[model samples]
Target: MKTVVIGFLGSILDSGGGPGRWEKWRPSVSICQHDDLVIDRFEMLHSRGHIRLAEQLRTDIASVSPETKVNLHVCDPANPWDFQEVYGCLHEFARQYPFDLERERYLIHITTGTHVAQICMFLLTEARYFPAVLLQTSPPRKQGSGDAGAYSLIDLDLSRYNQIGARFAREKQESTEFLKSGIKTRNAAFNQMIARIERVAVRSKAPLMLNGPTGAGKSTLARRIYELKKSRHQIQGEFVEVNCATLRGDAALSTLFGHVKGAFTGALSDRAGLLRKAHGGVVFLDEIGELGIDEQTMLLKAIEEKRFSPMGSDKEVESDFQLIAGTNRDLRLAVAEGKFRDDLLARINLWVFELPALRDRREDVEPNIDYELDRFARDNDVTVRFNAEARKEYQRFATSPAAVWSGNFRELSASIMRMATLAEGGRITTDVVEDEIERLQSTWRPKPSQSNLESLLPAKALAEIDLFDRLQLDVVIEMCRSCATMAEAGRKLFAASRTRRRAVNDSDRLKKYLARFNLDWAALKH
Candidate 1:
């Protein structure tokens, strides 16, 4: 195999004066003189003005190693220090050059070139634009001994170094584990999702949207992402978390974008809001779908421009913060209903990750149980463990379809805490497990309205309808059953919409909706 060394001409170093130039070591010439490190070919890059120096260096290389071939190429950038121009010139050179990876090994000489040019070479090689290792040359310690300069090859490919590769693999694994809260989850999809989330959290500063049911750890994961990025020195400010569902009207705007003195009825003083507090860090907007349309518009602007005016303020305040929005509600559906702004959704939907509900990841329940117990021990400073039979019994029910886990990890954590608190002598037995199971089942049991719907609708019909639709239908039916007339029920149901419309035909609209379910008011009331 042939050896190829590609590098810039060291104009100052290679121009070894007149006849006495041979005494000093030149990188380009010394590279070819090393007997063991043979350079079959040298592709020397230089600016057009350095053509004369390049020719002289090539001749000197030929003098030392007659077997080596020297080729010169012009790579002139307007400014040697301009990153873009230098990188472009080198990038184009690498793109046009014919590299025979199978027959020749390539080395990028980083010893000769401006710092920017060296950085570009490293980046190009690292990105595999040049399939080569970096060659760094240094002057010998005994400079006057006529010793050839020392040279070292740095291979960017981590796979070549087992220890370094293992270290990176370990670090990545630790990051995934950290994101998972150290739970040894068995769900393949959940594990894969965490891996991807870790990669994105580290590499990107764009807004991330976590879509999942309430209590599915969206907030927890968002916090973890903030902490992870903070640990990496990617963020410096505080992690500001706001539950958008709890914010309303003027208060929502004030809380998010701040408020000047006398902004509203209760504005006693000026206030800097959550977004400002999160500047240079992260802002997690939990239940973002619940934010009012007006607030959504302002939020969209803040996210895009990183600047927004506080209430009653003419000036805009800057808050450069990374955003991570969480929502259990389907924002797309909310948009269709005019509850959510589509543009806001579009901006935040760039990196959306849907967290699977606990029931969907039943295999992970056992690991989470352990995690919760460990957390309990840490928080309460009391060690608690379930007896063998009790642990088996809980695991069986936890992973079973019977366990709704409606509140996801939150519910599981609560259950573990309860059991840990009730455990006798730090041991949770079968009786404790059975009692916890009963409590969980009662908590998840269908409500009276849901039970009524089950009896009124056919089993097959109920199965065919989505849970969301079923719940809505159940409420509409209950409303009809309580009202004396169809119009009465329609008026109550459509009361909110009535105020907005000129001609409110509430009965007609209610009739159409009921017809879709193949039912009328008379049949529903009965």
Candidate 2:
């Protein structure tokens, strides 16, 4: 197999000892004569302004070894220092070059080009825009007979060098930090999860499922994934997002699969739908568990087949796209209850990730507060600063056990927005923080009945639940209190769901629900 070298033609005019010196010492020719290296072919790129020197150098290089094939390309950039123009020119030049990695080993000669051009080559090769190793040539320090300048092949994969690898590890950390909205989280588990998600976003096109409660930043993360992919050129089309929960019946069908004119009662004109518009890119179906059964069925076909018939149309339209589905609901439960398709669940079930709710990740709240304030300032064109006391007070309450961030980051973000809005003279004083705290307290505080119910439980049981769990338990206990028997309570709580439930065990179901809180039906009702 032959090796191919790609590089620029260094000007022969720079060689000092007249024409013969040019023949003997042209760097392009010297590059070919490196004793340890064998020349197969050189894809030499030079500007049109240096055509004569390029041709002369090409001939001199060819004279060194007749077997070597030198293909010269005329690549010119208006301003070499301009990264955009230089990269663009080289990119076009590379597109024209025949690159066959299977049959030919490739090397990029980095010694002769301008620094900007060299950087562009490195960037392209690093990106696999040009898949090749770098070859750097150097002149001998002292004049010696039969001694030639050195050549060494450099691999920029970073894995080959400990220092470079460690540097890249830092880069990966920065990438993760970017995804986290600059939050320097102390949670090792959360950071590891973000790293995994980062790889999936950059490498895979398979459907991804993000399962988490609302305000857990699933949608925000989805948008971030799309942006990262776009910046990496992994995806080309626009990010089309849809809240499946907002769609219902015919609207859902038409909104997703699109519709031809007169497809339905309101179909006065043709619609392309969100899925078709997301061609060659990403489609984020948030709250996917809320999609109707029919829409789920159609979506499954589109995902598996990459083609689907539009509403009222026989012909199928193709949309090559990646899928990202997010839901706060338990889709497995929905599938079991026949509210969602099990097969669709299995398809997207391949890459399932759960984003932790904000309250559970309280350690992240402080940094997120700063992030939200920055965002609010950017959006509203107002610079709001929290005074030292206000900042300390807010952080104390936000992280305290008494804080019931039931709405998670969404609620937290709103609280910050409210404080920033009401802050006098762009300063969030302690008074503003107190007002926000009072507002949150009013919102999250349990009703008297719920508090009374908590008192009825054993101290050990009370210790088992924080605010959120107690809120849910309180609702269940209220139902139990209203019913005559445990079976009646289960019937009322489960409602018409029993028809879809696989096994009819109302008493057992209620018994297990009560057990979760360390309470029994007899203890609760009697």
Candidate 3:
């Protein structure tokens, strides 16, 4: 197989001068001298300063080995010692470098470049950006020795070494733990989900869409991803975050894409906007489904082209950023209803991950309770311990099917904080847990007057239907009670869906839906 050697040129003048010069040895020259190593091509990478030295070394190598080919490549790194710049230069170089991995072997000569350059080469090789093995050259044993130095091939495919492979596996586990924020999650699904997110966070720059109920930790998880990526050196800029639900009209456009002076009524100064602020970093758009169509259109263009014009400005600005969007709404349904843009939804739906709500992950309640308690202790600087009875009571109620944590973690955090605040002598007693549980239950349940209508229907009829169908019925009943006429309730209930129909029959559809439950509008009105 043909072998290609890629390396930088060190100062050839440093190789002690000797008569007939076969006595002196250079790493690039010595590596070629090895009897067992056969190289068809040597790619010598040199800076502008090292051109003469590189040429002299090339002549010396060619004189000794007439058949071997020497190809000189110029690489100028802005800073040889700067890891990021060197890595970027090499990374770009590798991206464009032509490789025939199937027919030939490639070797990276790590002995000649700066340590930073060497490390970058190693990383690129490890990441398979540069599909090559490392070749390290050693100096001769003695000054007067007739022998040239040694050359050893470093194969980074860890699977060849069992112990190194084990270490790599352990490191992956540690990385996954860090991404998880050190929460010892119990659910298999949640653990697998976290692992998947870890992989996506490290490898992908495309927009990540997180969809879940309110307070399901979407915002917290997005921030965690930003921290994880930053720690991994994948991102360098600051994490720019904003909730789209709070942005409206001109404010949304101005806040996201910035605004030129005199753009709007109160546009007094030019703003850099969140996109520009997030350049070389991550931008998290929370409750993205709440964004208006105009905002979505601008976001779509910005995400694809990395360029957008500010409000009332013809000038386009650029910001290279990674995107992570979080929303509680079903974007697919939103797109179908014309409430969200189809193209924008399609783009973000590439890496969609749905976080289960607290109610869905009942098994995790015990761990989350411990997590919240520990967090409360750390935040308040006061050590608070839950009594055995109190802890058990809290877990029992939290995991119960009746426990509807409507606000999810937001509600749970407040509950723990409240309990910690009320705890006497640094101990949360069973009574404290019971009081919080009752308070949460009261908050979760609908008002007695509003929900009295659920009792109006026969219990047997509701019991005959499944929970899902029962919920749909409950919503319809609530709307009927609130609206003055059946037609008005129908219009509000299916407003978006009705727009797609050639002929609208809202009141009839509502009557038919109610009829399936053995109830009529006339009976309900009476």
Candidate 4:
């Protein structure tokens, strides 16, 4: 690891910036060139006299490892000249190491002076600046009669953007990973579903609709269909996702079908809608049940004709977008209730696949957790290994009622992160797992005065209250919890509803209940 000191020249203004200063005048801190190395900022920099600080750092590193290189590359504190000098020093430093243009190298900026140093260093390094990691350590602070203390460190790995983007695509099933995994790995009953989809997709006859519970991974499976159609079959198309809940009325229409200049207040220029952008690709409308009646009618026509006019323009614009929609609501119920278009439902119901939640596939949790743990560990630059105890704790959480994982894989991954952070001696124990569960359970549990059955009823309607009412009610009451909203009760109750069959047609009912209850059944189940 290369260590370059970009800012060591401290003035009275730089050293002390508090309301009043006594011996706490010269507060000093240090940043590690890499994440693993821990620096004793208070003792090494603050406690020691200014003249010996850098010398002390050199000595300390030498004591740890004689071969470590600690280079002192100073930058002026004023003007563009300072940045120019820093770049020159960095270039000189780069000369010592063999240059491989394709591979990424670290550019550690130790300056807290300005973002200018970072930006300049990045631009100077060019393509050679591989895997850039940025960390900003807070200026050290000194308290009464003691040395400086440093905390509130912010470290960001900028190189992970590409990887994160790829992961999102893969997790969303917009990549070939889905096809490689084989459709059989999906819900057992849906084995023939892929073949059925292939026929409809090939003919370009029907708009595809996927129905499942929230955590059932409908969006992910939709990406799989898109990937299969575009990548595997070599179909010419793009895959785009538009959450229907985010689009309301006018925005929904403009988003689906392009808008012309001056069409709306914000329309400064002509813009192609999601449909046009997805012309040769697949356009995925998530939470399709959230689409308004007018939007539904417009979408219905587009799906049938594969053409749509922009919001303001009178001329019809042609788009050959494969419509793939996903919803946790039942379109049948939605149509009957006059919320969703029956004609649109009829157009897209040809190939529907319901995804199985994570709890339903309990067998996958162990491997999935292990997979996520490795991912977190790798991202964190920690050589993390889960012991048998930790694995058992994970399994326990995996199987428990509390771990119903209504949010499916996403929630499970988050829980794993929490548990991993709390584990002792790198071993996750039952205590750690129980602590996490207790933390969640405590917040939702109710008190004695609030434990009446009437209180258990959902605020929206009494019918919406689940069977877990009394059990959770008592769970809350025993914990001396008082007064709870239907939303809170609903979250705790639905958190474990891994087996409840999601209604297919009750869009309004589900939305009202879910919104009022603030219950994300899919997130819990997943």
Q: TM-scores of all models?
A: 0.78, 0.62, 0.67, 0.50
Highest TM-score: give the candidate number: 1
Question: Can you write out model 3's per-residue Cα lDDT over 199-315, one digit (the tens) per residue?
Answer: 899999999988777888888889889998998899999899999989999999999999999999999999989999999999999989889999999999999999999999999
Candidate 1 lDDT (Cα, whole model)?
A: 0.88
Cα lDDT listed for each candidate? 0.88, 0.82, 0.83, 0.57
lDDT for 363 (candidate 4): 65
Residue 457 Cα positional deviation in candidate 3, in Å, after optimal superposition:
16
Candidate 2 residue pairs in clash (backbone atoms < 3 Å) = none
Tens digit per residue, CA lDDT, model 2, 206-310: 999887767778888888888888888988998999999899989999999999999999899999988999998999999898898889989999999999999
lDDT by residue for model 1 (1-526), tens: 9999999999887776687887787888889977689999999999999998998988888888998999999999999999999999999999999999999999999998889999999999999999999998888887656778788999998767899879999999999999988899999998999999999999999999998777889989999999999899999999999999899999999999999999899999999999999999999999898898889989999999999999999999999999999976656646765778988888999998878778778988888888888998999899999999999999999999788787888999899999999999999999999999999999977675646568677888878889999889888986675453456678889989889998988778898998887776556644
In model 2, the runs with Cα more than 4 Å from the true position are 1-163, 447-511, 514-526
Error of 2 at 341 (Å): 1.1
Look at candidate 1 and give me any clashing residue pairs: none
Model 4 residue 514 lDDT? 45
By lDDT: ranked, best first = 1, 3, 2, 4
Model 3 / residue 214 / CA error / Å: 0.3
Over the stretch 1-526, how does candidate 4's per-residue lDDT look in tens digits? 3422233323332344333443342322334422454432211211123444455445544554454455433333335346676566455544554544354334334343345555655564444442333334444454554333343422344364788767865654433335324322444444445445555554664577876556556676677777666654645777899999899867888988889999989999998988888887888999898899988887877877878789899889888778888876656656766778888888888777655556566766666666767876877766445667656765776776665465676677777788777666666776776677776456445455654444544546545667676455445332222111223333444455523647422333334554454443232221
- Model 4 whole-model lDDT (C-alpha atoms): 0.57
After superposition, the stretches of candidate 1 with alpha carbons farther than 4 Å from their true spots are 1-4, 15-25, 32-43, 58-71, 77-107, 119-133, 141-147, 155-159, 446-526
